[model samples]
Target: MGRKKTLTCRRWDCEEAPFLGGLCEAHHEEDRLKQLARRAAIDALSTSCIAGKLPEKPGLKDELLRVIRWWDKACLAVNAGRQDNVLLDETQYAPEWCIAFADAIIQEEMNFRQGLDDDATVAFLKKDTWTRFEHLEAGFMSNGVKRPGC
Candidate 1:
């Protein structure tokens, strides 16, 4: 009988057995949870954009920003290691380009809430922003970031 081969995780400076995709069990689970959270955050942000209402709940915007930043860090880590598909899965849960768009919407909404005068806020509210937001939301949802209620 042949002995099974022992392989270490591909992630740099680690010596854990490869569980899946050259990552150790810990790294694999961490990456999975990060992707899941990223996808959910993208969906929630898309939902908020579509609704055109800044959620009354505190820290929603902060959470979205944090997730986006985490994504950026993950990408950087992957790039630094020159490892393909290390931090992300095969699924296109959250695209790099869309994060910028999401951030822009978040920033706009935050600015509108914090900096805009009452009249400006009223004028902005009167515009057909909802239609534009809905279009953007539809695009994101269709691209695999699942929309809420669907």
Candidate 2:
């Protein structure tokens, strides 16, 4: 067997340490506790915001699923080093930013639909939620808007 290398925790300060990827057992336990606490808080907020009843808004649900799928694929690529960088160059960043903005708008529409009792507004909100992604995708720099070598 190869010899083991000694290491310190990556967390700043204090001598209690473990190999490479940081954290002694105690610190690792602490980190897990903190992470769970934060996640619980976020879950509480989401439940409260949705009135403890998350409805099946088809359009918003579909978009959320789509975004989740994209994120999963991106994460896989990142882990495999296929997507090595977050390109924040204007051409790449701008369209992505616009897409995020549009997604927020759709989320607002979904929230409004859930909160309000207006039937007319609900249909319009649903339409807006469905169409926003297309509008955002269109904003992406095709051959025309893209800067060279990007």
Candidate 3:
């Protein structure tokens, strides 16, 4: 019988035998940690935006832009053959929804600061806005759109 060839890690400069997905155990762990950090950062930004804790203009705008850019990249990845339908839908429309929600919050913040609304009125407005946003998000999820940190 002929001897079988040994497979090595696919990563450059690594000669260790692959443990999973063509990566050595060390490389796999590194990739996992990196993904965790990326997800954590996304979650933090998303939570801030959803809670309306960001300043009305620049802060909200910045977060919206970041999320939009992320979705754009995700869509590009999908186009490059990622083949996740739910991710594709999310990358297509969730950013737009986020923008709309952020714009509404910014407008409400402006009205609140301009003395057009009392504290109680502003609170109710915020509550209503959040409820609507939640409903919209739930609708997307129900339709099989899985957008994390959205």
Candidate 4:
């Protein structure tokens, strides 16, 4: 009897040999490309949200920058992968995943603003931005003021 081969990539209908990361070369490349696509999507979404150009809404560049900073801070928690940081599972929340989550939040916020009055929109944006930053800060600091092992 011949030795059975290991499972290949998780991608649909792929048959190539699994490479270093449990993915075949072709599938790996495809995955990489998909990740890049997600990033581009997020970038476009962020830009549109910042510029308020997607739905003919006015942009809030300053608020967008604040949101970006908050996103960056959240990302930093997972920046080191499993090497030193244990707060995040690198595999669970990679850069693409994080950006996608943020993108979704921004999209939803914009969608909500469409139906709201000007004062309501301003209040919503302020509350939303502050909540996100607070959530990130709490999530990152819940264990204590000092970062784990830092």
Query: Relative to the true structure, how large is the alpha-carbon lDDT of every model?
Result: 0.50, 0.45, 0.53, 0.51
Could you give the candidate ranking by TM-score, starting with the highest?
Answer: 1, 4, 2, 3
Off by over 4 Å in 2: 1-55, 84-114, 117-144
Stretches of model 1 off by over 4 angstroms after superposition = 1-6, 49-54, 58-150
RMSD of 4: 9.2
Off by over 4 Å in 4: 1-4, 10-34, 41-63, 71-98, 105-132, 135-150
lDDT of 1 by residue, 1-150 (tens): 443456788677677999999899999998997776456436644554423565433554564554455455545555565432322341232235445445444444555567743345423432333333343445433224544664
Candidates 1 and 2, the one with greater lDDT: 1
TM-score of 1: 0.35
Query: What clash pairs does model 4 have?
Result: none
TM-score, each model? 0.35, 0.33, 0.32, 0.33
Estimate, for each residue in 1-150, the C-alpha lDDT of model 4 and write its tens digit. Answer: 444466767654665778858788887888888777576546744564422344344444444555565455446655543421332422233344336544544455465567744455445645654654454355553223544575
The candidate that wins on TM-score is 1
Scored by lDDT, model 4 comes in at: 0.51
**What's model 1's lDDT at 126?**
23
Query: For model 3, what is the error of residue 3's alpha carbon versus the real structure, in angstroms, after optimal superposition?
Result: 20
- lDDT comparison, 2 vs 4, better candidate: 4
lDDT-wise, the better of 1 and 4 is: 4
Give the total clashing residue pairs for model 2: 0
Q: Which 10 residues in a row give candidate 1 its minimum summed lDDT? A: 84-93
lDDT (tens digit, per residue) of candidate 2 on 22-124:
7877778888876664553343233322224443554544444454443444445555556313221222333333234333434454566768543565456
Candidate 2: Cα lDDT at 28 = 84
